[model samples]
Target: MATPEDTPSQSDSTLSGCIRPFLTKSGLTVRCQSRVRSQCPSCAELYRGDWAAIARSGVFDGPVQNFRFYLLTLTAPSFGRVHRVPKAEGAKVSRCGCGARHSVTDANLRGVPLDEASYDYAGLVAWNRDSGLLWDRTRRRLRDYWPSVEFFVVREWQDRGALHLHTLVRIARAEAPRPALLGESARTANAFSKVDGAFVSWGEQGDCQAFRADGDGAKAIWYLSKALNYVLKDAVRASGGGARSWGHLARLSTAARMVRCSPGCVPRDCPSHTHTRYGARGHVVSASRRTKNRTGWSFTGMTRKRQRELRSEWVTAQAARAESAPAEWAVGVLEARAGRAGRELRSRVDVLP
Candidate 1:
């Protein structure tokens, strides 16, 4: 819905390529752009690795996992409502903060304030910037309250353009705090900060829910994993620029990391790929190699269900399908060893129909 008025445009694309489309086993044709070192015949895409890793993390396991699991959502307070689709085509007309009812198709008005004059852009941007600090402090405080607890956090942006966090926190069953107590701790963590000579807080206290992890893993993990799907929304692709990735998860404590893989691809004796642990003022106390962003800006045009399936087999399919024609092999005995393992890897990672 953006008009090409304020920003200058009109240059022909020097990058004269289009996203190549390919057919998948599920009867879906995926559109993906080729990357330089990509092995996937169809080009590597988003979330394939992230979901697998998170699921493999065992936080969602009902009894086997040692830590208690909880789902928490931290949000930016609303300036005003814009427009949204009703439950039915003409279910009900809800008034915006400005008192006028918005039409269903007025979806373009989602993030922008109903009355722009009153919206606080500076406050919103500041909160977005300092959110990493806020989260770090909150994690430390949670640990202080119960020394042995741990957490895994993920973040997503809302259609309203506010950065809301989706966290999978882990604590021992006996140490699990009451919902109200945890909520109070979260709000308490958001006490005032002086920014640009005016005081501002995170504004919203946020939401929390407990994950029972008792039912189908595919069903139970859906709520936690689907939060990542927000990156797939059109609003995110166009406007979310650099914020598409997790900013706070960058320097997350190594002790509190979300384990992404069990029997992970990295071989034993391989260089470690853990995160860099940063101290209070943003100094690195422990070091690990920096990694690239996980979520990307693209229109996969896949449904949420299809997206979920990709989490399991997407990377495996890509690896199996990759053209590794110039195969590395050792002399006689080692070559046999390599071939056996390669076959096993391929078999384990084969795409599910």
Candidate 2:
């Protein structure tokens, strides 16, 4: 068996020569010029493959679709926080005082591009399976809080490589509704509270944001592609083993490590740089309003703020209407007005309504 001593130091020339073929093939010769090449080709290959797959797959295609877009980000209740390997430091390492060196147990690794073990695989699977339901419930809540607000559901991956959701909600050019009138029949603020089977916790809650588009398909595709890239494969440790040992050892090692190294360990800077770039670009262009009048607030900005205020007002108005009139009648009246125009426009286009 190869002991830690047998494992080449990261700076070893022999190891570099051994991994030369893989390094060359991966086109990593450029990006890796500054750092000592990783000692383990197997691990390096795993890292290279994951990133390569994302790049090759055109994951950024969606985000590039529209100049203006909206993205709803959701985070799940942590199964528990896990420690991820830092990108700046490369992979983790375990060196004992006795000079006994061990590759950092994969269990200790976390964050993106290192190990997928830090993710809540079970929670992710569950969320993916129940995403449709979760979306429906969330939509219902939003509608109850602001009758005029509209939205649609789409699946998205969180920074931690787990499945979550992106809801494109439409706030139209209509009078503001009360916060009480937004989704189904609950307070707009509490829409998510009623979602059943949702593992809700206050630690990290979900968020919603909108952007104005230049009105192009390319921009929409860009956003979509970027969102899709967040879906990452499960992490596998880098170790040498025969074909026979691959499956069993991979599973056993990761499983054993999960106890000490919490799976689903999103970094403090989770969602990775890919998502961050998209956000930075989106915010730069879309967060502000583009108004007909140069001095007025950007249309997108004004629209978003108005939408919030309207939802609150609409909800309050609806509640008042409900108290004075028949509850069913009041709801019907409000629903009818909300359904009038922007519904179809918001539903069809990727642009924020």
Candidate 3:
């Protein structure tokens, strides 16, 4: 039954005074007390507690499980021309922009997609190639726009083979900002702009469109997960050589190489590698590697359900650890001080104990 009047505003000295002792006892140290950000020491303590709990759980006692595997595809715009070898005998050909008749030997005669018209397509491919950089840039821009908002960027290619980015962001209750305002700031930051505006608009195309999934954790994850599927479908189609209009082979080849490379190599020592440690703990867990034909790579180990369960357990453990800490000691001290002050006020007002 805490009302607005009963709650302390973020700027209030009384709230800081009440919270400081508990924070200190909890081993939370803030470099900039004015900023009110989650201190690293606090995060480390929570992470360690979660890790200890998970290690005790024995959920992953069995052999590793292989989770779902997906194929991603995308139709990329043709960037360059090549010698056109006619499959049919005596096939009629047209002259190229270079004034050479389209033929096997005449590389200049090869027709390529118009550069300006295909600028967006090119940009999209480049975006896919450097989606990690784009995500880092976007997150940094968002931080500048709103100092309290924090996020982690995860980049993946969709089945259709288009590059997709998934960002897991956390905004403190006191630090939440308007999504619309952040979106405006994002656009202004040149997140999807180009030297020429036409291609810029093309590359910026995504089902998620604007950055509207702010503050709402479930909504944001859903949007990102859906977008991941969309790009994966496109990537798969492009990889399968089905999108001939976009000159599928080259695009497919590039995507195939990327898939094989596994762009962000999740090291075995990285906390993300441990499926159970996600969100609550920090333990480096390497992605399961599946080698195909001595060249290709795919992830293996841990079903999605198990991963979810493990993550839930870890989070619960962290909350328990936070709650079990000596918060009551700080509370007891504050209550004693408040009780003495109340007694003094009552004595002055001629009240009996």
Candidate 4:
């Protein structure tokens, strides 16, 4: 009864279970700040791997209710049909070109073309490339609704490989000039930005909903974080390393052949619990070596403030680094990184309008 959105993309042959598993008996903990670490080589959050960044760099800080937040998702148009979880009971059941039922476990085939000969791979890639521009424009649109606001966006792929956006919009107490206006909000996020009386097209499908900072606040943040982790494999893959997580990776056999196991038996050499079902939705949005962001807006009021705070903290930590230099060296590095990231974000964005 669950749709593709509800069903996670995973196969029993590939389900790595539990929170990052411990493969070895050592039980040792190591640093995971390395951007190249993770199971999917293509994860982008490799560099921005701060969990606290979710709250500190979130739409707003503190004990909730200080600001207004909304959870918005923008989806790309369907290029062609592949397989989909039914929207409801007895929905039209379309078969792939291969003429198969396409069970829920056929996750790898979710966004793939039934007949690769007819799929628009090139168009899909171009849309993915300009995705950042669309997001930048979305930010500009939000400004018209609220005098001052902030947004946190994460880009992921639909089961069918179309890139979509999951955004968290923040408006401070001083920013919301009027009461909640769902009409304006929908026009801003779901519809395109305006230019010279013309509606600039964003894509095909978009959805937006407003949620207060009460119970919905944490839920929004968690959803954003989860989305980021999903597309991370592509980022790390382009960085030239196998995706590393908190668990120790174990290998059972090189072959994909099924291995029978005894009841209540767990193999010590089994690979770490890295499940791809909930993994990346698209391929590489942009390589890790690029200086700017090809995805979300990482620079806003909250982000800039958080960057300054992090610079101070990094400066304090320099005492533990090279003895010849003070915290200033590390501070310089972080500042440069932040600056480059902003430029990279603008690179794709400024190219659009």
Best by TM-score: 1
lDDT of 4 by residue, 186-262 (tens): 33453332211223334545655666656665776665565556435433122111222111011111111122122
Query: How do all the candidates rank in terms of TM-score, highest first?
Result: 1, 4, 2, 3
Cα lDDT tens digits, model 1, 82-155, are 34434336757777665667664554554555555555444454455455567767777877896655444455
Ranking by lDDT: 1, 4, 2, 3
- Model 2 gets an lDDT of 0.37
The true-versus-predicted C-alpha distance at residue 17 of model 3, in Å, is 55
**TM-score pick, better of 1 and 3:** 1
Residues 33-140, candidate 2: write the lDDT tens digits: 211124544434433333333332222223323222345555445543433423334555555332434343432333222233543544433333343444556555
Candidates in order, TM-scores: namely: 0.51, 0.32, 0.31, 0.48
Provide the lDDT at 39 for model 3.
34
TM-score of decoy 2: 0.32
**How would you encode candidate 3's per-residue C-alpha lDDT over 43-159 as one tens digit per residue?**
333333333223212112222121111111112233344334343457887554445555544322222333323323333444444433344465577667645443323334433
| 2 versus 4: better TM-score goes to | 4
Query: Cα deviation in Å at residue 160, candidate 3?
Result: 7.5
Q: Which candidate is the best by lDDT?
A: 1
Q: Which ten residues in a row have the lowest lDDT in candidate 1?
A: 6-15
Higher-scoring candidate on lDDT, 1 or 4 = 1
lDDT scores in order: 0.45, 0.37, 0.35, 0.44
